[model samples]
Target: MNLENLRREYLKGGLHRDQLADDPIVQFERWMTQIIATNIPDPNAMTVATVDADGQPSQRIVLLKGLDQRGFVFYTNLRSRKAQDLKHNPRISLHFPWHCLERQVKVCGIAEPLSAAESLKYFVSRPRESQLAAWASQQSRPISSRSMLLQQFEAMKNKFGKGEIPLPDFWGGYRVKPQRIEFWQGGVHRLHDRFQYTRQADDSWSIERLEP
Candidate 1:
């Protein structure tokens, strides 16, 4: 594989300043809607980054479950490695790269766990098998073998047996109330368009153009 040939030129999509939104959240919604309209696969997938106590960062892709003006929300086992990192350091960053659209959005904020009622509501809406699997898998834990997981899954199925599975105390959602948002659009010769919206002391947002 030739590393140099791996590059491909980006055609000017003509996405300019006039296309931007004054409110970042509204802009986000508009772009997200456009993504959906484009029929891209897994548009909700995003890379979530969290820092450990040592200030080292870790990142993984997670499905976006909810979003609003307040924050972006995602669900996972509360005791997973990511969740543990959040416990030690609430600050997190999320990135959504829609390569097909030649656009990306980066968000940074603090995370907070959702309420028990919210977790339970979402939990019950999941498929029975998924609910059982959630109960069986100790997320991020090292398992001896795949067979052990199958056995545990079967055991959980039997225990829950067509009954309402309770949302594990170790599983729930977190909302990242963004302090900063950056929108990037591809341009000619890497002179990309970058705009950032930062939250001010008075809770209003201030927008500025950034050098790519």
Candidate 2:
């Protein structure tokens, strides 16, 4: 296969500075609402990037479970690799690949653990199976076989036995308080339109157009 031949012009639309919101959180909400209305698969999905103590970087896709002025929120095992990385270096980045709409969003921020009450609120709202899975699997850890994992899952099911599955001690969520946000729109001839919003010390945002 000739990879170089795979090319297509982006003609979806253009993003302009005048069209952007002064607050990036508002801008992100606007885009998210539009995408949600379009019924795209996993519209809440985002790629989270983190770095470990030694400066090794890693990335993973996580669903955006919550979003507001406080920033983006997602859950995971506290012992997971991404969580470990975040514990070492609170700096994190998020990417929303809305390629189906020829758009994307990038976020740079600090990752902080959510309050226990907040995590429990979302945790109990999850389906029973998901709640059990949280207790069954040791995320980012190697397992000898699929069967062994399934066995643990089954064990969790029996242990719960129709009772409410309490949130695991090692499971919770984090909020990414964004310092910078960028919105990108696909333009014809690869001349994409990009706008960046940076947070100021006064808790306000400054917007600027960036070259694509």
Highest-lDDT candidate: 2
* Tens-digit lDDT track of model 1 for 1-212: 67876765567474556777777889999989989998988999999999888888999999998889889989999879899999989999999999998889999999999999988888888888889888999999999999999999999999988777888888899989999999988887877889898999987888888888
Candidate lDDT (C-alpha), each = 0.89, 0.94
TM-score against truth, every candidate: 0.95, 0.98
Q: Give the clashing residue pairs of candidate 1, or none.
A: none
Error of 1 at 28 (Å): 0.7
Model 1: residue 153 alpha-carbon error in angstroms: 1.1
RMSD of 2: 0.8
Give stretches of model 1 more than 4 Å off: 12-15
The regions of model 2 sitting more than 4 angstroms off are: none
In lDDT terms, how accurate is model 2? 0.94
- Residue-by-residue lDDT tens digits, candidate 2, 23-52: 899889999999999998999999999998
